[model samples]
Target: DVAKGYILYLEDISVSFDGFKAINELNLYIKEGELRCIIGPNGAGKTTMMDIITGKTRPDQGSAWFGQNINLLELSEPEIAQAGIGRKFQKPTVFEQLSVFANLELSMAGEKGVWTTLTATLTGEQRDRIDNVLVKIGLIEHRYQDAGSLSHGQKQWLEIGMLLMQNPKLLLVDEPVAGMTHQEMDRTGELLTSLAGEHSIVLVEHDMDFVRSLAKQVTVLHQGSVLAEGSMAQVQADPRVVEVYLGE
Candidate 1:
């Protein structure tokens, strides 16, 4: 049966690397259409948790589900992606040589070979989809430019546009605003907040000010488990969170 109003579920998830627990019996739940921010100190198992969800890493013990029916543990990385999970790493990875338009075209949901997909004529609906994503990512004006020619922040937005092309149900974004200018950071925050209700976003970031700008529910991880979860104000006031993370 489906877990009503939830998009993801992780229970008793644990993994070890060379006898060091990277994830220790972690449990998390993501509500449908929710925008959740995850923050943590280094080695706090944040990446590991995302890897587990995307099938990039396997755990020694746990159950993960997409919605209520899809068993994430039984799927491969590509399978998980095809099942509607999209991940964007800290670094922007647009096709530098390709036009912004072409990059999004290449990322469209399909099973066709890349060459065939690129060469095939796009239906009117497909073209409209690309246009819509360009507007959403704030790159409509740069659609014809080579991805490499865009500034760092624009490149990040383009990469996000690429993911939007696939229409994923859940998105795992890691440090999206790293190395961005303050203006870019604000724009990025606006973009992410706008997308929240339509797509469940799990954002893992280290920028306190950026995180505060989002003002969404926050989860703090430590020693392979969640140490704190609340509003930014509540967590910032947490003495344990301060002692282990903010205090440093």
Candidate 2:
């Protein structure tokens, strides 16, 4: 039954701003433990979709669900965050003054207040998790370094490490490799690929090369709804998708 459950699901979702429909009758689903890439042109409603799922924006109509019965539309933003869903925005927002290790430690679940977690000691289990996350994110060597001192790409990796600390069931990542070098992009591809089977991921990215490297199911969004869905090859071959995206 593992494959029968949907980790994230939306039905007839719509969002509008001043009479302009940002997301019009959007319907999408993500399977558990699947890494799905979402690519779209500007105003394609990618951000609006993430916003609705994360509780930042409520839809005008339709239902959003986490798992089977959990209604995403009824929950507040913090409630959604606590319900095992994690999101990483395009820009990295690490604590510049804190060490990489400290940032991850602070991001762990429980007692999330700034001053309280900063002063609390990590239990053995917490330490182990942080250590493992550092390794997984390829930041063990930089664990003690000031997060502000890292390069743009390194900071992105560190932010991802912070997300791992919570052990969320699903992660929504946005444009993770925007400004990285070729080497950094490849490493990021490897990192995201390694996390797929264990964590369901919905990534919004514009980098076709990076998306191709991941080689998973790709979804193309146009005018606020799905225009294409399948392997990258199939999506590229779709004339409608080609005209709106690849052809550009």
In TM-score terms, which candidate is top? Answer: 1
lDDT of 2 at 212: 91
lDDT per residue as tens, model 1, 5-58 = 889999889999999999999988999889999998999999999999999999
Candidate 1 global CA lDDT score:
0.94
Candidate 2: stretches off by over 4 Å:
1-3, 246-248
lDDT of candidate 2 vs native? 0.91
TM-score of each: 0.97, 0.95
Model 2 lDDT per residue over 1-248, tens place: 12347998888999989999999999998998999999999989999999999999999998888887788989999999999899999999999999999999889877668787788777898899899999999999999999999999999999998998888889999999999999999999999999888999999999999999899999899889999999999999999988996555
- lDDT at position 26, candidate 2: 94
